[model samples]
Target: MNQVIRNTALSAAISLSLLGTARADDAKDIDTVVVTANRSAVPADEVLASVTVIERSDIEASQAPDLLSLLARQAGMDLVRTGGPGQTNTLFLRGGIASHTLVLIDGIRVNSANQGNFDFAHLPLSQIERIEIVRGPRAALWGSDAIGGVIHIFTRDPSAGYIEARAGSYGLGGLNAGFGTAHVAIGAGFETQRGFSATNPAAGPGSYDPDNDGYTNRNLSLRVHGDVGTQHVALTGLITDADVEFDIGETAAINRELGIVLWGEINDRWSHSITLGHNSEDLNTPDFDSHFGSERSTLDWVNTFTLNADNTLNLGANWAHETGFSESSTEVSFDEGRRNLAVFASWRGHFGTQTFELSARRDDNSQFDGATTGNAAWGLDVNDSLRVRASWGQGFRAPNFNELYYPGFFGFFAGNPDLRPERSISQEIGVDWLATLSQRVSVSLYRTRVRDLIAFTSPTFGAENVNRAAIDGAELDYHFEHGAFRLDGNATWQDARNALTDLPLLRRPDRKLSLSGSYRFSNDAALGLDASAYSSRPDIGGDLPGYARFDLRGSLPLTAGWTLEARIENVFDREYQLLEGYNTPGRSGVVNLRWNGK
Candidate 1:
């Protein structure tokens, strides 16, 4: 679209605006702060990578059932789940595989080395303060599993006494409470829902189970921090337990994690931050009497030196050790572990009309040889209203324990202990615009090629580096806000195909679009609408048809410091399948009441 026409559309859309209400350009959000961009607070307009932030207010306004559902509607993201909350959920960012995107909680890595993925289904939004998602490869600064993007989750901290209670469709109810002071804070919540059936009636050949696949989840979190003379310290913890029934049987899953940090400005020119964290998960299937568990401990230290007014340098080192074990009634218990150490450096320089960045990292693994990755980027400020950037990066993903060391005695399935890590090269170009004081737009194009992709061998059914792929995509994001209304939307078109077969990668839609709008009746009340469309794509056994879904939400002030909120999801009752044999919810509703004490 022409610049004039696009600007006109942005201006026109605001008059037309849903509870999706904007803060009117002058209120609480005139300046957006993000941390995932450079490990420091940077304005979203100044970031080079595609970024999205979902704040606590956004979550409370939308009333999304879970974290996964909200993320599925975000730009450059695709999600597949077998059932409702507590199901096995997989997320793909910009056509990257499930393992390509790195996930962190309060600066601690959360992906499991056994499954090569994080359990988004079990992550409750009530416990999250804010979420920052950065799109594009970041391996140069973050190391492995960042070939696609990075998602950072910050747990909430309470400033005053607060509480909430709610109930929803299909046996949903929960309670949340928090209390805190200037130097000490704590927040905790608990919620549960009985979900819909998980399986399709007419599944493949003989894989059919007709029953409601209900689920139960419980979660708790705490955050506390204090400061001493010239130093600061903090500790954070989270635990979630779930019981879910799938097509075959019931499984219990538990995740527990803790993070600690101590850091401060050593001197005027130098600052340092140090972090230590531990994460563990335990899963059990009672029917088959199977168990899979993993534990990981990590430490990181970083120092920043100010070279001059326009130049800065950062040096960091990280160490991590992970262990995994699996046991079943029929098979003997097996345990495997690996350790790695990494060092990285990044330089940022600002000159007239231009900003430059360069970063490199090296990791030495106990199970394999050392690997090195690097990235370079340049940003040109065309004027006060526009900025353009280009970047190139290299990344890699280590094989998970299930892929390399899971001992399967059965003739049909086995592991390949010698499998190698998948590696990739990526490039992208983008332009950001601030056409008006309250309107913004961005366009980005990117391509990534991955070699040494791991797959199961045809006959032995063991993991091997037998496949390669190339993915190319373009994205557009727009945000506009005027009096009494707000509009946010994004669209993506991608071609993710097998390098040799040329077939579309499984479950990656070719096109996806989302739009949300909110209209405020007053300062404390609003009505919002959301819409999502996904193009047809390949699945495990066949192709799934394309579909669109709509949701309605509203918020109203009930009393002092209390609000009443409600939402109806799948308003049209569209029938869709994100996975081959999975069923999605149809026309569900939820209501919540909350109190914010300051």
Candidate 2:
């Protein structure tokens, strides 16, 4: 306990030190707008939630190879990869399970119904315009699978035409091209890499693989929008096709999302929007002779009323139809479908220097009992430079198709038809201090309790809701910008444990820290450094030792509309593993040549 406390204190000190030492000037409130927090556009500072926004500038500055690598540097996030690129990847938010975090692409749900989770391995950075991460429960606004929070990805909306090509170590190569006009934008990217062996013989003979693994991916994104009279309409589509080679065999997967959205002002105080979306995934594994797929169709209608400058009301309804199918060599495993309908509402009021919000939701599922969730939040503008907020919310997640009706696996594992949904409650309080226009600091503390967690245990190896979990955590963030230099840092400390056993949850570290800085030269060139650290974590084989990594990146102007960009990853080349038997990338370098056109 002493060690844990000391480590937490050390992490906090590192983060707070940035704020105290910052010397910046002429910093202005950016007033970034976010939608995932409330299902409607709200300024980030005004929303009473722990949110992080990764914009295009941040993405290019880091030059991360994949979405998994980029998200790992954020606060309250942990990631596990079974192998190299294109392998199984899982994301845990706020110490919650992979399925607890809901992912969205342009307001369309993309999680597979079979596993109730989205794989981050195949998602490339080329197609993303921005990412909004909201930590903590959000079931009051979204229907289910939001115990941890939400991650919403917006597809590329290029403002200018650009083409880029890349080459690096490990036989990596990629090409990306994009263009935009008044009403439409399109982007395409292709990448391939020769990766190292995925498994280590130390784990077991079955886990040993001497041959090299490889990954290939092709992706496309499109967006079109226009204003007709007083109504605005937009259509977005994204698709990714990937093939991965492993020791035994190979797997081919495809992910696709499409959505159409329309919004219009109904009156002086009323506005409404309607979104129709579809998401689907297909995976095929020739080695196991298995094929699995899932699809979801959804519709959302939201109405907003501006009662006054300081008060508002939001009402929304959601409907979704989902299906999952699986088959093996000789026979079909399971083919099932389900439907859900939900209605939600929220009220916000501001009185003096205090802000209050209350929200509630009811969801009816075809296969399970109806669930109701709610949230209440309060905020105080203590002064011009200080603000405080607190929030409490309830969340729940239904059993996935695999956990409800899948047949036994090799006579060892089976799905239980009679399983209950997991439920949770979370509370958090936060403070934000605008020390100066160019310097800001924020602190948040949160706790969550989850019940009826599903697990496969004991003799039968069947799924059962016989477990519980508890998580307590704190987060600190600092940002500073002075002239041509900028700095950002964050620290996270969490105690996520199994309630019954009192053991730390698997694959989730107790402490995490990240520090990043960047500088721009007068010639439009830039340089950046990113550093991240994590504590050891418990897993099936044993405890995985902690490790730290650093990456150096820079961009240089070559000529008009031409630039050179490069990154050196794993500067120290520290050997480490994200999973018990998996291998991580060593020191490597990548360089890119990009051309832009007006």
User: Model 1: residues >4 Å from true position, as ranges?
Assistant: 1-31, 329-331
lDDT of 1 by residue, 1-598 (tens): 1233222112111110000111122122323655566654345776678888887778777678789988888889999987777888889998998899999887788899898889898887877767888899888888789998998777776656678888888778888888877656666777777667787865664556776777777877666666668666677788988888877889999999898776656766676677888999999998878999999999988777767667778788999999999998777567999998999998877899998888899999987786799988899999999999999989999888898787765754577778888999999999999999779899999999999999877787778898999999999999899998999999999999999799999999999999999999867699999999999989877889999999999999887799898899899999999888778889888888889886
Give the number of colliding residue pairs in candidate 2: 1
lDDT of 2 by residue, 1-598 (tens): 1233222111111110011100112111223555678775566677789999898668877788889988988889989987888988889899999999988887778778999999888878887767889998999988789999998877766547778799998889999999978678888999999987888876577668788899999998887777668666778888999999887789999999888876656776777777888989999998889999999999988887878777778898999999998998899999999999999998877899998989999999998987999999999999987899999999999999999888877765788878888999999999988888789898999999999999998787889999999999999989999999999999999999999999999999899999999999999899999999999999996899999999999999999788899999999999998788888888999999988775
TM-score per candidate: 0.93, 0.94
What are the lDDT figures for the candidates, one per model?
0.80, 0.83
Q: Every model's Cα RMSD, please?
A: 7.2, 8.2
In angstroms, how far off is 372's CA in candidate 1? 0.5
Which structure among the candidates has the greatest TM-score?
Answer: 2
The most accurate candidate by lDDT is: 2
Give me candidate 2's TM-score against the actual structure. Answer: 0.94
Clashing pairs in 1: 18-517, 18-518, 18-519, 18-527, 18-528, 19-527, 19-528, 20-518
